[model samples]
Structure formats: structure tokens, C-alpha cells
Target chain A: MILVFCELKDGQIRKPSAEALSEGRRLADASGKKVGALFAGASCAGAAEAAKFGADVILTAEGATLASYSSDAFAQLLADAVKAKGATVLLAAATAVGKDVLPRAAARLGAGYASDVTGLSMADGKLQAVRPVYAGKAFATTTFASAVQTATTRPNVFPAAEKAGAGAVETLAAPAGDFKSVVKEILAKAGGKVDLSEANVIVSGGRGMKDGANFKILEELADALGGVVGASRAAVDAGWGLPHSMQVGQTGKVVSPTLYIACGISGAIQHIAGMSGSKFIVAINKDPEAPIFKLANYGIVGDLFEVVPELTKAAKAMGIGSN
Target chain B: MKILVALKQVPDTETKIKVAADGKSLDPADVKWITSPYDEYALEEAIRLKEGKGAEVVALSVGGDTAKDVLKNALALGADSAVLLKGDGQGDAFAVAQMIAAYAKDKGFDLILCGNKGLGGDNAAMGPMLAELLGIAQANVIVKLELGEGTFKAEREIEGGSEIVEGALPAVITAQKGLNEPRYASLKGIMAAKKKTIEELDAAAVTAGAQVSALALPPERPAGRLLQGDASQQAQALLQALKDEAKVF
Candidate 1:
């Protein structure tokens, strides 16, 4: 059997988790094994949602302590599920929560895990995965031959596959790990609609954006395209953007979205390390010498100040803007 | 108080990276090494704590011969001493953590610090994995840190949020972008770094887990076509393409 660690939050199903479940089902089908879904939380409300997404068996780690994510506790729970289900493979989303918790789980199981997998295939009952290393500068073909293999898929890389009905839910006994750390409080930024990773189209600005006040242009373009606004490391470092969620590069989030629009970005190598994988890239920069033009599928050698407003107006008039 | 900061030598952030002949790694030959940026924040924060409370700050790095350079930067930045685990062969975070934790076991340090992640491999694995191995409380991407009587208070960045965590002394913390603005090397500090003795140790394997097979530059993005003419013409062209060709609004 193959297991997918279906991540949940606030007693609700997360889109990334749904994508994981969908990918897990694909892997299970290829391996001819049952797809077991694992959820660690205080309640099983979200576990039931995984079933509708093609989960065959939903394993719940329902306990008071499982309410929040503790790496050690969640790893033990997932490891136990892997053991109990006799799963030969496990999958998790490469989100922030998954990144923190999965490595510990792999360590507990003493199983090798391939992370940020952009490609996976099975041959002769062994799993082959394509993962990028050296900060997105290189790709590696790694094989996991252990009885069980684990991998985490990048968000939005695999579209969520949803079906009609919920899968079968099986309540599990309490997981057996004591967690010492706790989340005292969480303070989040004010509301925004687009998720940085999940957005199909991304409109990003860099240091050339000049100032925080200039971000309004990018935001307007993003709103018109119904996309999220991302910032480069330079802009984020300069305090023009948030650090946590912004997709910077190489060391930051690797996104392979459909359309990536870079405005006033000079395309530093470190910055290019992250989002170079987008299917279609558009660069809007006044400086014709900017390196971003080299990678742009469409290069606009005009002032972003003028280009962005025009782009926004054009998108809105075309009915692509915000509802 | 005593603090230990872990560091690594990575390619200068501006280097136009070239893929290694093998395709699974970068060509290390022409790349000039610099201290990983995030580690600088860690070192600075440790120094601030040491200066404010009269603490001892030691810098540690696990890498090949070149990694010693990172410690020199740390010392120049204000670390009391330096340690280097020399090895070019790559080991996963677990092994690297084990080497550091083993060294840290007898050091009697009150706190451990490192960058949230390094740019070299970009896995962001070592600090948290080390904390786990040492059975110490940890928080990553810390924006603010305060040393109290017996506990350490920190603000760590999460996905789209931030979390406030409190832990006892001897905890491991990873410095994030906004932790502190790292200081530039002073002339006197640079001279001192040249004289600083970096205790070199051999790195060992922790686990035979993930291995890199090849490296490749990302595929090139296609050239973009501009919608020329006036605003209305541009809008019409864009709309026509969306309705007929691109199919994306």
C-alpha cells in the first residue's frame, strides 16, 4: 500500500493536501497498491473530506495533542500509520507544514525520503523520482528501493484530482509520542485572496519596483489577472514585502505555474533560481539590459510604470480582472 | 550565557552558477565562496546576545577545506572561536546535524543558532533536523529573539503567518531574513579573522538516505510577444488572444 499524508488545518481540508491525495492515488494505481490517507488532528472532520478525493482508507490520529502540528508527534503518528497499513510508499505535500514534519517522520521510520519531487515513476516495483538540488540549479534522478519510499510533491505541480464521494474513514488509536514544544500564539497578516504557491498566474515585482508604495501597480495587475503578487528577495529584504510567503529563489519556494509575469525585475541569478520553471514568462522592465528579458517568453522593453497600468486596464476591460 | 552559531560557505549570491560536468551539481571551481547570508544573521544575533549579557559565542561549520572560510567570517563578525568539520563529500542534514550535535554535546553551550536554510543545496533541512537529533526545542526563521532568565522567547515566521514561541535555555534557533541586519567586517576584525585559529575536524556520514544523481539548469523560458500599439489596440489584441488563442483570461 501507498500512503499520502493528507495535511489539514483548522478542521478543514487544505488544497495542497487534496493535491497530495490525488498524487497518492496516481502512485497507488501505478504500484497496484491501496492508497491509505493519514491525517493527524484532534477531529476527523477533514479526514472524511479526503475520501471524496480518491482516498481508499483514511487513517485518523485523533487526540487532544494532535490538534496542532508538532514535528515529533506528527512524525510518530504518520510513521505508525505507515507501519500499520504496510504501506511501501508515502507521499506528502511540500508545503511549509509538510516540509517541517516529514523529514522527522522519515527519520523515525529510518526510510529514505525524496523531497520536492517534480517527477515520479515506478518500475519493477521500485520508485524513481526526479528531484532538484543545488537550489534549483540541477536535477537528480534518485531511486528509493526500501520496502517503503517517501516523497513530497511541490504544490500546484500536480493539480488536485477530485471525485464525487468521500472515501471510507477508519478511526485510529491515539498516536504514541509526547511533544514538548507548543505554538503559543499565531499572528497572520491581513486578508488576501491568492495563495502564493497555488496561483496559476503570478505577477511579481523586484527591487526595481523602487518602493513599497509602487507595489500598488503590481497589485493592480495581479488583481486584474486574478493572480497573486510575489516579490523578489531584494524587495522582501528591503522591507517592501512579507518574508514568509514571498517566493524568492534557489533557497526559497520553487513554483512551476502556467504564467509568471515579472515587472521591473532585473533577474538576479538567486532570484531566477526559483521561478524559472513557469510555462510562460513575461518581463516588463524599462531597463533593456535587465537579465529577466533573457528568460521572458514575452519581453516588453518599456517602463513598468506605464506597462503595468496599461496591462491592468486592458485585463479589466477584457473581463479578466477581479470579480 | 554561551551561544554556538553554525555556518556554511556557499557561492557568492551574485555568481552566475554553472552546472558541474556531472550535471547533478554546480561547478565549484570558479565559484568564489562567501559565508551563507542567513548564517550571518545568526552570528550577528549571537554576538548581540553575547555583548549584551556577556556571553561566549563560538562559530561552527561542516564542509570541505574551503568551509573554514565561513568560520573566519564568523570570527571577524565577533565569535569568540571557530570549529570546522572539513569534508567535501555531501551528507544529508541528519549526518551534518549529528556531526555538529556530537561536537555540541560537550561544549556546554546555552543556545545554538543557524540560518533557516542555506542557499547551496536549498533543502532548509539541517537546523530543524539537528534540533530533533539533540532533543532540543527549536524555532526557525526567527524574526526576534529575547533571552530571559531561564527561557528564550522568539518570533518565527510560518507560512503566511508568524508564531511566538517560548523555550528554555540550550534551545536551537534558526535566524530568518529579518532577525537582524548583519554587520559588515571591520578592518580590525578582518585582520583578526586572518589570525583566528579554526579548529578543523573530519566530517562523518550520518545516514545513507537521499543522494543527488545529476544537476541541470532549468529549461529556458520562451520569448514573450508584446502587444504593440496604443492602449485600446493592446487591450483588443490581448483580449482577442485570450478569447481565441491563449484561452486564459
Candidate 2:
């Protein structure tokens, strides 16, 4: 059997979980095995959603101990589940939580593991995966040599399929393990800022924004467009952004937003490595010679202080992002 | 307190990577090597902890002699000592983690640090895998950290926000960017580093669990069609393109 770990956020199944399920289904079909899903948390409210993406069985573990993410606990639970199901292949989305838990679980099981895989296939009853290395500059095809194969797929890479399955949910007791670290508190970002990795639209600033206060203009524009505000490493290094979480560059979050607007940002190769995957790019800068113009779908050579407000007014008048 | 920081050397991010004739590796002819950027953050954090709490910082790396450069750089940046796990072949994450864990097992360290992920592999497997092998707790991708007596509080970035986590001593942490600003090596520090000797050890023999069959570059994106007009006209055109062509808005 092949197993996929379905991740949940606030009791709802995430998109990446569905994608992993779809990939799991493909792999299972190729290997002539059944595809199963494991959902462990305080609640397994979205087991049905996993079925929609082609999970034959949904294994759930719910208890107070499983309410929050603890690496040791989750790894133990996953290792137990893999053993109980006799799963030969395991998959999960390569999110922060998944990346933290999967490697530990693989280590416990003594299984071959790969991370951030973009392509997966089964050949001769063995798993093959392709993952980006060197920050997406190159791809490497890897084949597992252990008895059990495990990998975590990168988010937004695979298309989720809505092929319904039985999705029979089975509740299992949470595995007991030693827990040394625990989450004390989760501090949610104010203003409901979308995560840079998952945002559909992103407006980013750089050192040309001058200072921290000037970022307010970019934030306003982002809010008006129903997008999130991002910063180049230069802006973050210059202390123009409060948290480094908003940074978008090679050393920061790699984003592939649908629309990425570069405001007053000079495009460094590191920065380009992160956002070059955006479907559409817009560059607004005072320097026409800025490297950002080379990658932008639209370029405006003007003072961003003036150009940005004008663009914001135009977007507002057109009801561009009232949603 | 004694801290161990795991470091790796990688090709400079800006270098034009050319796939070697072997079809599974980069051509090493003209590649410029530097310490992984994120590892610098780990090294810097260790130096800060050493300065603040009278800790001894030891930097470690796994590779051939080229990796010695990274340890030397770490020494120049204020690490008290450095060690190189002498290995010339590529090992999967599991093998690499096992080697490091074996070396760290007998060493009494209060904390272990590494980059969240190395730029060369982008695997993000070493730290957590090492933690598992050592049977210790870990805080991955931590941006802010506060260490106390045998305890630590770390803040890690998640999807929509950050979470504050607490772990006890002998914990492993993978440093994220922005954890600290890495300091430059001064003349005095460089001179001192030149005099310091880097300890070399043989890596435990382990078979690679994963085999790489091929290496290829991603398909290049088509050149963007630049819009022509004033700022307002360009904005209007972009909006139209979003609605009509991209269908994103």
C-alpha cells in the first residue's frame, strides 16, 4: 500500500494535501497498490476531502496529545501507521510542518527519504523522484534503495485531481512518545496577511523605498489589490520591514504568485531566483536601466512614490480587487 | 555551554551553473565556492551565544578539502575551533546525517546549529535527521532564539504567522535567515584564524540510500512582453492583461 499524509490547517484540508493525494493515487495505480491517507490531529474533519482527491482509506489519530504539532509525537505516529499498514511508499507535502516531521519519521523507519520532490513515478516497483537542487537552478532524479520509500512533494507543483474514492475513515489511538519541545503560543500576523509562499498576488519593495515608513505605501497598494506585501532582501537587511518573514528572495521565501509587482526594487539574481516563476510581473522604478525591467511583463519608468499612487487609484477605480 | 554549528560550502548563487559532461553534476571548472549563506547565520548566532554566555563554538563540515575553506571562514568569523569530516563522495541525507550524528554523539554539546537547508541540495534533511538520530528535540527554521540555563525559546515562522516554541538543552536548531547579521572578519580575526588548525576526522562509512540518475535544468521561461506607455497607461494595460490574458483577477 502507498500512504500519503494529509495535512490540515484549522481543521480544514489544505490544497497541498489534495495534491499529495493525487500524486499518491498516480503512484499507487502504477504500482498496482491501494492508496491510503493518514490524518492525525485534534480533529480529522476533512477526511472526506481527502477522498475527493483519491484516497481509498483514511487513517486518523485524534487526541489531546495530537492537538498541536510536536515533531517527536508526529514522527512516532507516522512510523506506527506506516508499519501497521505495511506501506511501501509514503508521501507528504513539503511544507514547514511536513518537512519537519517526515525526515524524522523516515529515520525512525530506516526508510529511504527525499525532500521537496517535484516529479514522482514508480518503475519496477521502486519509487523515482525529481527534485530541484541549487535553489531551482537544476533538477536531480533520485531513486530510493531502501525497503520503504518516502518523499515530500513541493507545494503548487502538482495538479490536484478530484477522483472520488471510498475514503473510509478509521480512528486509531495516538502513539505515545517522548516530547521534549512544545509550542507555547502561536502569534498570528495582524491584518490577515497572506503567506508569501501561497499568495496569489504580491507587491514587493526594496531599498529604494527609503525607510520603514515608506513601506506603508506598498502595504496600502497591496491591501487595495487584495495581495500581500513582500520585501527584497535589501529592504529586510536595511530594517525597512518588521519581520523577516516578508522577505522574498533566494535567501528568503520562494514565491510563485500569479501577479508580482516590483516597486522600487532592483532585481538581483538572488531576488529573481525567488519570484521569477510568477506568471505575470510588473516593475515600477525610477531607473529605466534597472535589471527588473528585463523580467517584467510591464515596466514603468517613473518615481514610484508618484507611480504607485496613480496605479492604486486606477486599480481602485476599476474595482480590480474588491473581492 | 558548547555549541556545534554544521556548515557546508556551495557554489556562489550568482554563478552560471553548467551541467557537467557526466549529466548528473555541475562542471567544477570555474565555479566559485563560498560558505552557504544560511550557514553564516548559524555561525553568527553561535558566535553571539559564545560572546554572551562564555560558550565555546565549534564549526563542523562534511566534504573533501574544499569544505575546509568554510571551516576556515567560520574560524575567521569567531568560532573557537573547526572540524572537517573528510569525505569525498556524495551521500544522501540519511548517510550524511548519520555521519554527523556519530561524530556528535560523544561530544557534550549544549546546542547544535545548522542552516535550515543547504543551497546546494535544498534538502532540509540534515538537522532534523541528526536530531532524530541523537534522540534529541529540534527547532527547525528558527528566526529568533533566546537561550537560558539549559533551556531555549525559539520563534519559527509558519504559514500565516510565527510560533514560539520551547526546548531544553542538547537541542538542535536550523538557523533561518534574519536570525542575526553575520559579522565580517576583521584583520586581527583573519590573522588569528590563519594560525588556528582545523581538526580533520574520517567520516563513518555508510552506503548512500538514494541514487541520482540524471540532472537537468528546468525549462526556461519565455521572454516577457513589455508594455509600452506612461505609468497610468501601463497600469491600465496590465489590468486588462490580467483579466483577459492571465484570467487571474
Candidate 3:
């Protein structure tokens, strides 16, 4: 069986986790394997959604102790589930929580694990993984020598399949029911519809955008794409964008998407680490020599002030807006 | 209070990359090395904490001969002392973390700081792996950190939002960009860095379980085909590419 760690928050399946579930379903189909999902929390809303996405078995733990994420507790719960089902391969979304807990679980099982994987397949009864290194400038093909292989997939890179079904559900005992810490308050941005990390089309600004007010240009393009706006560390550091929480780079969030439009952002290696895997890269910068143009599948050497607005209008005319 | 910060030296982000003729590693000839960007934030936070709350900051780094340059930069940035885990410049995340964790265990520090991730090898695994190795509490990609009497409060970024976590003293936290503003090295500090003590320790015991098999540049991008239009027209072109050419979206 191939098992997925279905991450949840406030009774909803995090979009990244749903993408992982969808990818897991694909892997199961290719290898003739069973699909199982493990989630730890009180909410069942995400489980139903995972079922619709092709989960054959859903394992949930709803204890209060499991309400919040603790590396030790989550690792323990996942390790137990993986063992109970005799899963050959385990998958998780390469989100913050997965990065925090999966390594510990890999250590617990004494199994080697790969991270930030963009592609996966079963080859000759072993799992073959492809991941980017050196900030996406290079791709490495790696195979797991361990019996049970583990992987974390980048979000939005894999589309969620919509095959409808209600999978079997099983509730398990929560591990370490009482936590040392609990979330007191979560102060997230109010309009959560277009999270940059999960957006299919991301329009990002950088230092070249000049200031916070100039971000409106990227926002206009993002609106046209039905996606969220992103920024580089330089823009975030200059207070042109939110803090590191919204920054995309080596120190920020790693995002893989269908379309990543970088505006006025001289692609720093660190910035490329996060989004280099985006399927189609469109770089718009006044500087023709900017590093981003080297990796861009499509390059526009013009002022973003002049180009982005036109591009946004063109996108809307195409009627291929973000869903 | 006393803090330990781990720093590293890496090629400048804008440096032109070249693979070694041998195909085993990056070409070192003419490559300029600088302090990792994230490490600057770590050192800055450690110095600010010491200045505000009366603490001492000790910096550590593991690298080959070129690493000494980064160690000196750390000294100029306000670390009271420094240590270099001398090696062949081939340590993986696990090996580097183990060596640093072992040394930190003996220092009796109240807190530990590290860059959330480094450009070299570009794996963000060291901080968390080090926390696990040291059996210490950990918070990653911290956008905010507050240190008080025997405890630390931090905010870590999640996919769609953020999570606030707390841990006791002697914990480990990786410094994210907005966690603190890094300061420039003063002329006096630059001169004084010449006199600071940086002890070099042999690190043959550090074992990196994995190795880099080869280094190669990514496939060259296909020549760009500019899409022209207003927003709607561009959207149509992109959709066509997704369906007929790229087939990704």
C-alpha cells in the first residue's frame, strides 16, 4: 500500500496534502497498490475530500492531543500507521509541517528518505525519485535502498484527480494525547482564498517593484490569473511585502506550480530554489541580463509597469483565468 | 545567557557556475566565496539578543580551508569567539549537524541559532536534524522569536499561514529572513576581527552518510516564444501552452 499523510487545519484538507493524495492515487494505479491516507486531528472534512480524490482507506486520529502538530507526536502516529498497514511507500506534502515531522519518522524507522521530489515512479519493485538540487539548477535521480521508501512532493506541481468515491475509514488511538503546547490563536491574513504557496498561477514581485505600493501591479496580474501574489526576499526585506512567511526561496517556502510569473525579480539562486520547478516560467524584467531570463521558458524584456498590465489583459481575454 | 550560532561560506548567488572538468563537483577555480545569506541573519539575531539581554554569542562553522573567510566575517559581525570544524568540505547535512550538535552539547549554551537554510548543497535539513540529534526543542523558519527567562517563543511559517510555538531554554531555532535585520560590519569591528580567536578542530569523526555523486548544469531552457496580448490574450496563449506544448497545468 502507498500511504499519504493528509495534513489538515481547521477541519479542511490543506490543498498541498490533497495534491499529494492525488499523486499517491496515480502511483497506486501505476504499481497496482492500495491507497491509504493518515490524518491526525478532530476534523473529518478533509477525509471525505480525500475519498473523492481516490483514497481507498482513511486512518484518522481525533484526540485533543493530536489537535495541534508536535513533531514527536505526529511522527509517532504516522510511524504506527505506516507499520499497521504494511505500506511499501509513504508520501507527504513538502510543506512546513511535513518537513518538520517526516525526517524524525524516517529516523525512527531507520529508513532513508528523499525530499522535495518532483516526480516518482515504481521501477522494478523499487521506488525511483527525481528531485532538484542546487536550487533547481540540477535534477538528481535517486532510488531508495531501504525496504520502505518515503518522499515529499512539492505542491501544485501535481494536479489533484477528481475520481469520486467514499473510501473506508478507521480511527486510531492518538499518540501522546496531551501536548506540551497548544495553538492559542492563529492570526492568518483574513482573505485566505489565494495563498501564494498553493496558487496554480503565481505572480511575484521583487526589489525591482520598488516599494510596497508597487505590489499592486503584481496583484493585478495575480487577479487575472485567479492566483496569489508572491515576492522575493529582497522585496520582503524591504517591507514591500509581508515577512518571511510569504517569501518564496531557500529560506522561505518551496512552491511548484503550473505557471510562475516573475516580475522585475532578478532571479537569485535562493529564489530559484523555491520555484524553479514551476512548469512554465515567464520572466519580465527591464534588465535583459537578469539571471531569471536564463531559466525562463518565456522571456519579456520590458518594464513590468508596461508589460504586466498588458499581459494581465491578454490573460483575461484568453479566458484561461485561475479557478 | 549564551548562544551558539552555526555559519557557513558559499559561492555568491550571482557567481557564474561552472562544473569541474572531472564532473565530480563545482569548479572551485576563480569562484568567490562569501558568508551564506541566511547565516548573516543568525549572527545578527544572536548579537542583538546578547546586546539586549546581557548574553554572549559564540559562532561555529564547518568547512574546508575556504571556510576561514566566513569565520572571520562572523567575528566582524559581533560573535565573541569562533570555532571551525575543519574538514574536506564534503560534509552532508547529517554529518555537519552531528558535529555541531556534539560540540554544542559540551558548551552548556542557553540557546542555539542557525540559518533556516544555506545555499551550499542547498538542503534545509541541518537545523531540524541538529535539533533531533541534540535532543533539544526546535522551531524552524522563524519569522519572530522572543527570548525570556528560560523559555523561547517563536512563529514558524506553514503553507497557508503561520504557527506559534514555544519551547524552554537551551532550545534551537533557525533564523528566517524577517526574524531580524542584519547589520553591516563596522570599520572598528573589521579591524578587531583580525585579533579574534578562532580555534580549528579536526572533524574526521563527522560522518556524512550520503555523498554527491556528480554535478551538472540543468538542461538548457528551450528558446522563449514571447506571448503577446492583453491579459485575456496572454491567458489564452498560456492555456494553449499548457494543453498543447507544456502539458503541465
Better of 1 and 3 by DockQ: 1
Which residue pairs clash within candidate 2?
none
Chain B TM-score, candidate 2? 0.93
Binned by DockQ into CAPRI classes (incorrect, acceptable, medium, high), candidate 2 is medium
Q: Candidates 1 and 3: which is better by TM-score?
A: 1
Report the C-alpha lDDT of model 1 over A113-132, residue by residue, as the tens digit.
Answer: 67777887776886678876
Which CAPRI quality tier does the interface of model 3 achieve? acceptable
Residue B180 accuracy (lDDT) in model 2: 88
What is the TM-score of candidate 1?
0.91
lDDT of 3 by residue, A1-323 (tens): 99899887667788779888898888888889989988887555566667888889888887767666776677767778889999888889888788777665654454556676778888876677777665676665656656777777877777777765458998888775543333444556666665666677888888888888888878877787787888898888785546566688765666776789899899888798778777789888888899898888877777788778776776676665643
Residue A133 alpha-carbon offset, candidate 2, angstroms: 2.2
What lDDT tens digits, residue by residue, belong to model 2 across residues A1-323?
A: 89999888776778877888899998888889999999988778867678888889999998877877888788878888999999989899988788988998888887778898889999899899998777666778999888889999877778888888888888889856448787778989887666888788999998888998888888878877889999988888885545688888777888877789999899988788778767788898888889999888777787788778777887798888796
Q: What DockQ does each candidate score versus the true complex, computed on alpha carbons?
A: 0.48, 0.65, 0.35
* Candidate rank order under DockQ: 2, 1, 3
Tens-digit per-residue lDDT, B1-249, candidate 3 = 889989888777656567778664678788788877877888999999888987788888898777888888888988899889886543356667767877788788888898877775665667766776666677777778898678788887665667788766677788777777799989998899999978998864754333444566767767776666654455456556755787643
In order, the Cα lDDT scores of the candidates are 0.75, 0.85, 0.75
Which candidate number has the best lDDT? 2
Per-model TM-score, in order, reads: 0.91, 0.94, 0.86
Per-residue lDDT tens digits for candidate 1, residues B53-148, read 898999989887778778887888889899887764244555577688778877788899998777666656677667766777777678899888
Give the residue spans of candidate 2 off by over 4 A: A286-288, A300-303, B88-91
